[model samples]
Target: MFLEKLASKGVTLAQLPIPVVRNEVERLVLSYAQQRQWFLWQMEPDGSAYNIPTALRFRGQLDLAALQRSFETLIQRHEALRTTIGEEDGQLLQVIHPCQPFELARQAVGTLDEGALQAQVALEVQQPFDLARGPLLRVKLLDLAQEEHVLVLTLHHIVADGWSMPLLIDELVSLYEGYSQGREVALAELPIQYADYAIWQRAWMDAGERERQLAYWMSQLGDDHPVLELPTDRPRPAQQSYRGQRINVDLGEALGLSLKQLVQRQGATAFMLLLASFQVLLHRYSGQADVRVGVPIANRNRVETERLIGFFVNTQVMRAAFDTQLTFSELLAQVRQRALAAQVHQDLPFEQLVDALQPERSLSHSPLFQVMYNHQTRVKGERRSLPGLEVESLPWRVHAAQFDLTLDTFEHEHGFSATLTFATDLFDAATIQQMATHWRNLLQGIVANPDQRVAELPLMDDTDRQHIVDGWNATQADYPGDTSIHQLIEAQVFATPDAPALVFGEHTLTYAQLNRRANQLAHKLREQGVGPDVLVGIAMERSLEMVIGLLGIVKAGGTYVPLDPEYPQDRLSYMFEDSGIPLLLTQSHLRETLPIPAGLRSLDLDGENLEGYSDANPNIDVAPLNLAYVIYTSGSTGRPKGAGNSHQALVNRLWWMQKAYGLDASDSVLQKTPFSFDVSVWEFFWPLMTGARLV
Candidate 1:
């Protein structure tokens, strides 16, 4: 039925060639990465298929001939509109070729229900569009009355971003008005095509500009790359997934005025005030003296670029270190100065900055900043309406990204609204609710006494703060009264000894079988002279053996460093050398790939057991404070730095989870994450400690 309606509207797929210049190969590559291609298909690791369609809706009485003419002229004026992909000398490139005039159709609806028509338009617009194959652009018209109509346009992400929408709209309106009056068009010629800009960018980067930019980033991000230690009841995930929620906070007129007055007294702006408040909140919540966040800068400094549409946004990392002795006003001034300095040096792209700094990428978190703050002033314009038609702009839907949390603020007529978007998979609704309450309390406190020091502020007045502390200290009642991970595992050692405890791909390991294998590995490690204060490197693919190897090292009273097999050999060697690993555990299949130092002993975890060990064994006495594992995160030196954790920390986290979520052995958790990620740590140990089944 949908296809039939589309067919009646005269919409059809058109083939065109996308052109590219040969000299700008590097730019082409960069453009490929920057250009969004996810729209073409929705995919999962498992094969499932879906199609995306571009939808357009129109309202009011329409002039079909005039609209068609306007569209043709507009397409002819923009080179990108007629571009398609083609192969040149076995290389894919954008070919600039003319397309046949787009097919247009007119549909008459006798009914005059405005609300129903708007709903229908919204439904059509919500459909996804695939952009990888080609440009997915559509135009629709809705007749609201005999003299009025609405035009709806939809475009694929591959061809445009938010910046491009304004340009397209301006051009469309101008062209449509000219065609309607049958007058010769008067439009300025584009000085440069999108392709030219891409080529120029590549050339500019290759001409020593990129190196200078890199140097600046490296110096800016110094040593001691510390993470914001936000207390978490559960561990972090390895790979980021789309699971998020949003909360909106409105600042009333009085609060806004008070904030302005406070900022004026401190010689700063409202943005600085907000940033300072957030820094204090982060300091209190994360218990970190220093906090860093990523701020997006619109790179449209050039007058010409203000009109051109593209991805011209770059991220600036803002670092704020808080001391309890410093007053909020003083901190605001400092933040204002630093923010200005960052703005002066905002030419570097985030991706390029990452490559230059080469920070150690962590599975549990982003390489740089996890939190984002944005403040935008809306554009002013009067809404244009056709006769007998009322057109209103709809609120944009929230699109999830790979950040831990993002907050955006926009100036409203009366005051401002701060929208907080967070990952739902990592944070529950209760947590977000508390966050909102805490934010309001912080803002109110600052407004009440602008000269108050961050530590001197009355945080006790906030109920969420007390709630968080109470929740953090709460104890779980579902666990076996008072028992540790080792004690609980011992209790269930015989009951489910033969049941499958771990499965990966085609491989499965029973509880008894896994325990015996771990014991054998532990014995092997002991033979290799591994013990307390020693770090054992576990380098292998994501498999059941990898998990077994990690558990075994800890069981053997040595800390384990998880080495992702996908990491570059140089990086792997650096981590091994830096951590002073005396021994490594890996599969024989990857022996050639991971050639370690001659003195470092290596054992194959995948091969047959060299030591004859029985399942029955004397219980090993493991202490709660013993070293458990070392997780390597991003370092300022372009190398990974390992963060060591004690068994106490892990167990404390498990106990925190038990108290917070009431998880027990009866709960079955699907271990779908990799071990390198901290989130998997919870999924792996919490169940084992509570006698819970790990599916």
Candidate 2:
């Protein structure tokens, strides 16, 4: 319809020919894309990671001769299908053979089941192609019955890509239809072949075009290629793995139309919108501001290579900066600007970009980007329906993960759908399944409210949120939430007064004995005017006396500040200044060597006389909000800093430990870590509060 209007207005669509390569057959250099494939083939010579297979089930009166002839005609038209790559002078070059008679191999299986037929298709896909040999494209036909047939077409990615598959399908249908009806082959003659385009591409790049495109890409992507730190179910392998799985997501017909309408309003292409949504999803999952996703462009802007079947795909990295303040509409604009610039400079060979950027080489991930995004306009197995056959597309999943994760979205007539391909080595199927749902939710949120912040967009539905927030966090157990940490120990003392509480080498203190001794020290601390909000420093080794000192200070309604005796004098002095402890509890043996600040009173616990103090719990009132303890950090930067926690918070942590680990009276937790480390707090108090011994 649009073409009719243009024709009436005297405006024709002109496809000017690209200059053809003249008689250049002797030394044909492989394109940069093909060279990259050759390098990959050398790395994995026996793997089918690069095989591209397409299968279809034909149920009708099948014409065997015309099917065979269609295969020959395809190979004859595209020289790359019959070509092989060979090495000479340290350069991988193309070896295009003359037109040869191609024969489609056929296999006869009597009434094979569905599973068996699928297995046959997978067998063809997994068979590695020998790039050094002649035929880069191969086909096989399986005869299930007199009227039912299955055609499997496999091509090495070196000679074909995602864009070339549809061209082969459309041409095969047309050619088979013509041949079956005994009509002449009506396909137009190509202006140039794949070899001619490869040669022309090299010539075009050598004349300063390479530098021009390289400058744009370098300025856009730069030398920095941050690996997208996607959370995985398992540890990543030391080397990359091709094992993968795929999941399909149906966005529904309404969502599909909404996406198209949203794109039209944003003044952006569908690719741009989907890419932006992908960036948003990645940013939310990774919590990263800089998100880099690799997008594959067809690289067929020129008319000459439009109909050719070859590997002409180029990858462009679309990097977006995200933040909580940026709106989705703002993000779309940013993506549009970057996407347009990328398309303008998309001709730079991805291999050359990798060489120039020189990102940190990794065997575990693809350089420059680990995530891939692609939108397909061509439907799989979509072709002209032949005269006498009902064609049904048979899915041939190569199950190879080319990248860490690749989201391939497809545009359909009434709706849109997507398939997520993920590396099984790093991700479980469930993880990828959630990721697909999250991506769809993100797209839905974007279409609903374009002005909302991208960070505010919903990536999950109610059920998913419920599973993560409520179901996984069902560790709720009743504990004394309003009580202080020391009060719990007192309750334990009442429940099992005769149980062993503290055990050191060659020493032990029962619950009753420990509470009575702590009471005596607590009375002495009260005489020193230590009350609520006061900080008393405890500097001592890990001994039975150390436990009494900490418990005594807290019982006197004062916060105990832990000072590791093993720390340097300078660090200990800084801790005293930061904590402002007017009283220091230490052993008499270290009084002479310790750095005691002037006017700071120091008491030796080992030498103090407590014969007259009452062996009863103190009567001080300490609320749950009162400061419990102050722990000084190592302060690797400069001076030490103290972090204070409330008694309520400390008790909550101890209670959680008991519920999580199910600690019982028979269990003994070894308190080997120093008092300064936070882990030691749980190690010290968890067992004490749960009727378990703390050793």
Best by TM-score: 2
For candidate 1, the lDDT comes to 0.64
Candidate 2, run of 10 with poorest lDDT = 15-24
Full-model lDDT for every candidate: 0.64, 0.85
Q: On residues 361-435, what C-alpha lDDT tens digit does candidate 2 reach at each position? A: 888888999999999876765534678897778885547888889999888787678899999899998998889
lDDT (tens digit, per residue) of candidate 1 on 1-695: 32233245463323111222433343233243243233223332111111112222334444566668877776776655655444456554555556667765444444556566656555445555434345455666655556544555765443445556667776766676666667767778755555555444554555566787667667667765676666554567775554555776766788777777777787787777788888788788897887888887766665545655444566788888788698887888778988887776776667677666666777566667888788776642335464433334434333344467777777656666687877655776577666666776788899998788888765545355556678766744443333335455545556777666666667777667777777777777776777765789989887778877876787677888888778778877888788888888999999888858778888888884746854443345656666778878756576577887777677777877877787654577788776666777788777655556666
TM-score of each: 0.56, 0.90
